[model samples]
Target: MKHTYTDAMADIETLDTRPSAVVISIGVVLFNRREPKVKMKELNLKFGKKEFRDEQIMMGRTVDKETVAWWKGQEPDAKRIFKQANVTSMEDALNKLTAFLTQGDTNYLIWGNGSDFDNTIITSLYESFGMQAPWKFWNNRCFRTFKGEHGHITRPPEFQGVKHDAVDDARQQARYLQAIYAELQKYNILSYKERQQ
Candidate 1:
């Protein structure tokens, strides 16, 4: 079946019984997407909901620019900074994400676990921004990765250990997806047999 945000939500209802299509994780590290094996030239996104109320609740709690910079052990690269239009509000965040999806040459979305909170936030932002969500692609059909599971994939040994430290978690997620993509290629090779009713 085709994937979408709606299908993803339904899948979330089924939890372990369902697989996710796309995810909407927070933090720069959470959004990395890089090719497997090579382990170089990462892609990152910088977007998040900014409901004034949510912002208030998050202050002194959620990682802020300063805190994230400190954690990175350096200042944020200029290009990696979230654009002002995207950071202004939750609506802006959605607008920015939509632009990222449509304006870019690439056509893929990933999430470490999008079905849960990330999807919810993006869904809200999309509506608030007055856009028709490509619900299917966003729902049940995007790629995904997980934390602390069997058949585990690990990042470059240099990046080394895996932990929930949002940074490492995100890298592990990319590694997991790289492995899944390889497995899917293997499955594609067997598809002809499955189709030969």
Candidate 2:
């Protein structure tokens, strides 16, 4: 069977780990589960520190003390986005993501690191803005779950950029997930042959 559906890996950097996390950055990469270049989109939100957290809290977003402490303990490189000069508001960022995800494709399988993390947070943000998420709910996927289930592949891609940077993380995730998909295809083909014997 020919594969035609588009797959994407979405990631976010945030101040909390809940559905209502105060999202600060987002990265998404659209690709086929094959070795090829991907279309990437990234956005860094302008953070006003206490003011920003208060504003998002007003809109029903959340923050966590441990997440804040974790960020403080990270290396300076991983925390660079907080110092970014060029940034967008959350509304504009979500709008751009919607445009990117829905513009060139129809059947999409959007992957997040975890089922309850990236996609959930993004969807919550859309709800905060009273807007619709671009991808269908059923089409959402969990890369963390897939990896945990079938992580038998021996080799994986090298890390590209700083750990906390959303864009770099998304690219790395999509590559590894693609490797897993290839391994599954190989296994399926072998299993079919065994069944025919």
Best by TM-score: 2
Q: Which parts of model 2 have CA positions greater than 4 angstroms off?
A: 1-5, 35-54, 85-87, 189-197
**In candidate 2, residue 126 scores what lDDT?**
91
Which parts of model 1 have CA positions greater than 4 angstroms off?
A: 1-51, 54-86, 109-114, 142-171, 183-197
Each model's TM-score, in the order given?
0.42, 0.84
**Shift in Å, residue 179, candidate 2:** 1.1
lDDT of 2 by residue, 21-43 (tens): 98777878777764444444443
lDDT of 1 by residue, 80-100 (tens): 332212355544544544554
Q: Which consecutive 10 residues in model 1 have the weakest lDDT in total? A: 6-15
For lDDT, the strongest prediction is: 2
Clashes of each: 9, 0
| lDDT (Cα atoms) of all candidates against the true structure | 0.35, 0.75
